[model samples]
Target chain A: MSVGASINARGLTKSYGSGEGAFHALGPIDLDIKPGEFVSLIGPSGCGKSTTMLLVSGLEPPSAGSIAIDGRPLTKPITEIGIVFQDHLLLEFRTAMKNVLLQQEIRGLDRAESRQRAEHLFARLGLVGAEDRYPWQLSGGMRQRVSIARALVHDPSMLLMDEPFGALDAISRTQIRHDLEMLWLETRKTVLFITHSIDEAIGLSDRVFVMSRSPGRIVDEIKIDLPRPRPAHLGEYPDFAAYTKRIYSVFEKLGVYKFD
Target chain B: MSDQIAPVTSPPTPAARLIRAGWLWSILNSVLSVVIFLALWEGLIRLFDVPVWLVPKPSDFLGRFLVDYPEILRNALATSVTLAAGFGLGVVIAVPLALLMVSIGALERGLYPVIVFLNIMPKTVIGPILIIWFGVSPLVSVLVVFLMCFFPVLVDSMHGFRAVDPRLDYITRSMGATPWQAFRYVRLPASMSHIFAGMRIGIVKAVEGVIIAEFIGSSAGLGFMIMRASSFMNMELLFCGLVAVAIVALIFNALLATSERIMMPWVRPR
Candidate 1:
């Protein structure tokens, strides 16, 4: 928590449509993520978790307030960050390796250098021999791994993951969570991960921001005390009871204790 | 044709099974079907003692087809040339127009109704209008085929271009990809399958368009040959000409199928 703020946002707010149909999509809340920190945003379906990620990534502008990344204002579209979306969104015609190289093409970086980096990343990410395979040929987990490789291929400082494992089966999700922990431990990049599951948020992050729905805003910020090399099964860990209990307590404050 | 495509990573089990049935089986199947159909027709015609001016006996049709084979080949060549020209031009022009229509709202608004209205009008009506403007020539035949081929390709390409997942564009743009880069890398490649769908239907329309043109106006193609046969009540020759037309269409379809396979190796041929 002592590290300098990697991403600083003050009074950040996003809304859609004019009066009557006007909808508050996101916050007017202050946020500060420390350097090399992993933070998860947990909220209901309409809680604007994705909108916050988009606003920070410069994909959308906040109606009021600003976001600054590493002390640099994100007033325009920038490539200093990478995002692994909920959907892998891999081009079907392309091979896994070529899809990773897509980051290079977008960044206007050297192809040979990016290919070498992609090879290393793919291998490190457990995609060694599957580089030649198309997205359809690979399993859902593999596609998500390829997407992770793509996000890192450009060597961006920050990674914004919008529930990248949300679509995967339980086994794949648990498996990838371990792999992601390994990835983060090695790279130590600033990350903002968004998910609906309280277990996922507490299982992965150093900090968890519980959000409320409708007029979405951060309602609680819990510094996760779960130890590193996180427990594979949240149910198996003794500390999970305390973390889950606390996250549910936040939800209960809104009169909603659903665990979906 | 599918074999010429790169070995797809996902094995297409059903398509592979169909292919394993082999060329010999396919040929025999078609030959058997054709024989049964011709035999039934021949039996009915002979039993009825139908006039030669009506449906001629298959044997008599074959004999006359052999005699007129040289003329049939020449007419086939003329029609094929015009059809190919029109179809090729239609592909080159319509696809770009389709892209323009999808990319620009103003163009879509101004030209869409005109395009739809033109497509709705009977192609036969367009043939005479083309003749009136350009005179009785091969150009009219080519123009008619082009017109027929145009709408399908335009519609299909537009569909393909818009068919790109909006998320793909969002991801590309969020990654700082310029509009042109997004179009080149994501939009265009994603649209290939749809564009090819258009080409498949467009090629068939091209065949019909060229024939209709020749039938109505031109005097140097298979359609003209049909006219000549009908005028003389040469039922065998007319049937032979019709057979030639069908063969030509089969060739076009085969050619298009191969091109589709070559261009879009990811798409399993159905």
Candidate 2:
């Protein structure tokens, strides 16, 4: 298992175009995620949480600011990481197993070892018997699981998920959230999970950073003291409810919800 | 719930049975319709005492088809060669050209309007020009066919390449995929169905092109044979050539469909 790398961002910002037509997507925000920590960037639509995740992964260069991974400045894309998008994004031509093995194929990892890891991941993600099936053959949730398996198959030190379960049905989302939490507990890879769901952020993250809408910056950060493998009925816990209320209040204060 | 429903192991339902036997039924239906139409044509021609020069009876056409089998086969071989050569060249050139144009924005900008202008000009018009330039040779027919086959494949290929979801690039990039790896693993495979679709259209256009080219300038081919038969007023031979061209087109389409199924097994019906 690869040990997680600490992700540090200083004054990270992203802008599209320039001058009069410029769109400020993200902020001159500073973020520090400890190694092995599971952090969630929770925000509303267009809050730039996704931008922050992309910048951290170094998939896109920040318009301005700096990012360092494991104390090393990220000059190019950080390849030692797995990313999951809301869309399953499985290569339709590849089988569910082959989709996961794509990482190994591209990265030139040990084929035998990677295949074994993929099989293990398949089982863990409840994707057994689905290895040979194409993406079109799988359910929404099952497809998402395959993508998650692909992310973990390479055993990257960090995982970046941008609303990985956003497209799933409610029940599937709950089940997958539970499964993801279990996997994270086992691997303990530094996770930067971006989501709009407060419950999901609070349910899974070690720390949740709440951001305001558009030109999004972290407005508040809340640390969850919830127990490991958190209870399904998180609303029952006073502490959990308090965390939820705190995040909701932050959003409310930002005028996300308005009452006349 | 999985995208596919559970496989039916019990007795097949009425709908399931119909679907299971659908292809066979459709083939039988088409054959029956053709037979009925032919029977009607044969009867009407005989009753009217129609001259063979005007319109040969189905019997005479089939008779001429067998009697002149060697000659018809020779001409068909010529046409097939032209079709294959032209279509093959078109695919080889158009697909790569499309990839280049799509990969390079400047190339797309510089070349797309020129391509559109060329495609807008009628292929039949190009046939005479090609003949004038290349003389009465097989190369003229092949070049005409190439012009007809190139545009659709190029346009559709560009469309396919552009249609790839941007997020897929992000996923592949995170996997340490180089630009070439990303294209090979993602873009190329993703664009395959579209490429095949373009090839299908291109092949049909190629058939039209080859025949027109042969009509204009070719010394041989089914089109050339038809022109020759018409000059001699041998309607039977003319009909035979027409049927041969139709059969050849059908065979080409069937080959294309089969290869498409083989190449894209994921799209195969369960």
Which numbered prediction scores highest in lDDT against the true structure? 2
Q: Residues A1-260, candidate 1, lDDT per residue (tens digit)?
A: 11223999999999999799998888887889988899999888878899898888888888999889889888886676778989998999888898999888877889998999899887677788778777777788888999999888877788899999999888778878888888788888888999987878888999998888766788989888777898787777777788888878888888666554
Model 1: how far is A18 from its true place, Å?
A: 2.1
Instruction: Estimate, for each residue in B1-270, the C-alpha lDDT of model 1 and write its tens digit.
Output: 001113355545534534544343455676788799889989999899988776778888878767878999999999999999999999999988998999999999999999999889877787878878988899999999998989999999999998888878667876789888998888888999889889999998899888889988897889989988888887889999888898788778767765665555665334
Q: Per-residue alpha-carbon lDDT of model 2 for A82-193, expressed as tens digits?
A: 9999999999999889999999999999999999999999888888878887788778888899999999999999999999999988778888899999999999999999
lDDT, candidate 2, B16-41, per-residue tens = 44445443454566678879988999
Chain A superposition TM-score per model: 0.94, 0.98
- Docking class for model 1 is acceptable
Query: Proportion of native contacts found in each model?
Result: 0.36, 0.58
iRMS values in order, in angstroms? 8.7, 4.2
Cα RMSD to native, each candidate? 4.8, 3.3
